[model samples]
Target: MNLIRLVLCVCAVFGTQLAQADATRYPLTIQSCNRDVTFNEAPKHAVSHDINMTHMMLALGLKPHMTGYSGISGWKAVTPQMKVILDGLPELASKYPSVETLLNANVDFFFAGWDYGMRVGGDLTPQTLTPLGINVYELTESCAFVMKRPPASMEDTYNDLRNLGKIFDVQDRANALIAHMQQEISEVQKTLPASKPRVFLYDSGEDRAMTSGRLGIPHALIEAAGGNDILSDIDASWTRINWETVVERNPEVIVIVDYSEVTAEQKQHFLETHPALQSVDAIRHKRFIVIPYVQATPGIDNVLAIQTLAKGFHPQ
Candidate 1:
């Protein structure tokens, strides 16, 4: 009964638009600690908290409009062009900043990456920020559900670029970028041979294996790069598992999430020192690629992530 009320409430909030399931244009809502709203019109003075969300905005040439970025990390993987755009935004914090800091920046818009980090930082919700004339947008990919209907796949990435193009009013640039990305995806598609190699997405936490989802951007990148996600059975987007499972799956390639000043040697040492992991196929074959934490989400970095993984998977 409670579940039904929640569903009814959401449907009412988004309007009866879901009734026409076929319609592409409809309101979408994300439930962070609080519900954040997105409008059909353009946003100025936008503040992006999610790196991928920020990258999406940057792709639309919206960086100049971005007031400040919360949790500003992953400056390395950004292409020179994108980095040039990002360098302009002030670093508010390594992760989400305090509510007072955000208010000080005078942001008119708020975009959070995942509900976890942002919500954990404080009560920085749309309800709290809206009265101050700031609107919030949370990434749909970060929603914490298995989604009975199929989640967005690579095909949807192109469609999303078009949809985002409309929202940002960068239709021309969006179309051109999509054309270039599609061409690249096509070329790489031909190079990949038929083999479903299980892969591990290792984050540099040093304790448990914090990894990607079975269904979202990380999984898509793995498949796009011609590898299978070892943890694809887990429905959640981000998960942490034990070495027991790591040894059990024994992935062929390991994509390590490099952060801070952790060098390539340090990451390899973690794998090499672990007696259980040393014999793993990935370590045995020396198949490891350091994926920057930024592209871990769904954004411009995703394209580069696929390219990086493709190189590691099929090295010279």
Candidate 2:
């Protein structure tokens, strides 16, 4: 009789724990782009896309919830910051996965951006997935025209981290992370040069010079780093300009965006060998600085990019 009573008591305790755990007390609803997203409970299985989006998940301590992820192979290499948090998460694809693959993964949530999962009528968009009861969140900067957006700034990065934290019930971690980033940015901004140098961001293109413009985070990064984006006059995030136009502007320093396909050395060589750039100040003086392609984008690394450019541009 004592053994039977002991078993019944144990079962009662176990049942109570299960019932409490099953209660979804916080039903979260937030406006994301064109859609109203509601999360009845935190997602147990998730899929993330692109470096920045994946980094956000890991930074928020959501790695255990991420059943699978995609787009890690595209980076030149996994950054040290990403390496520690990644912790052997399964990679679903080197790039974006197909709608069928996403469906098969049985992910309850998707953390991706416009180009990552929603490519102009491509499958696996929030429009298609939300109907199936999957929650989706877009990287704020990538939501540029999908919704009315403020100008790209470090605030966008903070908002993303904060939103993800709220969704996953980790608001404290998000606030702490944002505070650290803000402090770092403030320190770097204090050391800026009195005069901003004219900088040309070399992203990759032999035929035409493709560079960053006023619309994207790179433009803000240039401004923060004590340099002026010579192509800032352009309204779009990134655009193409001719070699003659480059000569006309005559940037004082060249900031080469490093990626896997085109080495910074190759771009430096192209600038040095081109006849049109013979008299260009940056090329002639060989004042070239290389930044990782990921750092040039909006993410946790943007602060580091700012500090790097400050040293390169002001090198006094």
Candidate 3:
């Protein structure tokens, strides 16, 4: 009987130790766009790429864990709250890092999308780095094959943040962040107009206009802000469309997507001077609302984009 009791006591101790190890090391597995990735312990040396992933890390207060990052255009694109966090970190590259650069950084983990680093058949692809003891995670919205859904929603933001929280063992912070975002979104929703405005999203183009379509996040943001996207019927995310369509639809408000190279003013000038667009009511009245190109996509900045658009639509 004493021997049996001893075995029970040993089992209890072992179980307790196992639980403690889990709490500390955090053995976790997450299914990404194409594969299942497992982490025996949180990454000590990690690198993030692009504004979307970098902003998420900052929001979670995980700066200490990140050793390096890349792909941010400028301080102008970054929110002030995030800029303070980014100012203290090491920048690996102004754009996407080369495979050699990433390897030399001794990085154990990478946070980037397919376009950012894991492009098909590229040297920095997840498939290439996985064998080298490096783990790569693609941004949720950037996953196109077998994982993406048409018309992105804010829920994608919540789920992505929650996943990151799980990986870093900071689920509480993620939950709080999500709750705050929801509250901000709710406040914007309250100020929405009774009638949804017809919004034309002009990205940039002279010969053929490039614009957001049904699969893009801008379509979802416009709907959330109580505006109807004239090109929401197009199935692709970003596509080139004829100016005749713009002239026919005649959007009430022109939403100019501001980027680093192409300023919002340039796009506005193009629309204002376009021979075909002169008859459009938005052009006639010069009703223009500008949003940073980064904010129009899937990211934490989307709520702010919604709020800005709401005010533009309902200008009280």
Order candidates by lDDT, high to low.
3, 2, 1
The candidate that wins on TM-score is: 2
lDDT of 2: 0.76
Could you give me the TM-score of model 2 versus the true structure?
0.85
**Per-residue lDDT tens digits of candidate 1, residues 46-103?**
7777566666666656676777776656434444554565676876766657677777
Off by over 4 Å in 1: 1-41, 73-83, 115-117, 120-122, 145-152, 155-163
User: For each candidate, how many residue pairs have backbone atoms clashing (under 3 Å)?
Assistant: 1, 0, 0
TM-score of each: 0.77, 0.85, 0.85
| Residue range 1-316, candidate 2, lDDT tens digits | 1222323433444444322222234788866766778888888888988876776676666788888888777655466655655658877877778776777888889888775456546677787888877788887777764655555778878888878877887665566666666777899888776898899888889899878667677888888888888877776655677889889999999988887667889888998999889999998899999988767777777877888989999999
Q: What lDDT score goes with residue 244 in model 1?
A: 84
The parts of candidate 2 lying over 4 Å away from their true place are 1-25, 79-84, 145-148
User: Between the candidate structures 2 and 3, which one is better when assessed by TM-score?
Assistant: 2
TM-score comparison, 1 vs 3, better candidate: 3
* Colliding pairs, model 3: none
Estimate, for each residue in 1-316, the C-alpha lDDT of model 3 and write its tens digit.
1222323433444444332222334578987766788988888788988776777786676788888888775424555554666787888877768877878889888998765455777777788888998898777666653355666567767778877877887666666666666777898898676898789998888998988787667887888899988988776666789999999999999998887677888889989999999999899999999987667767777877898889898797
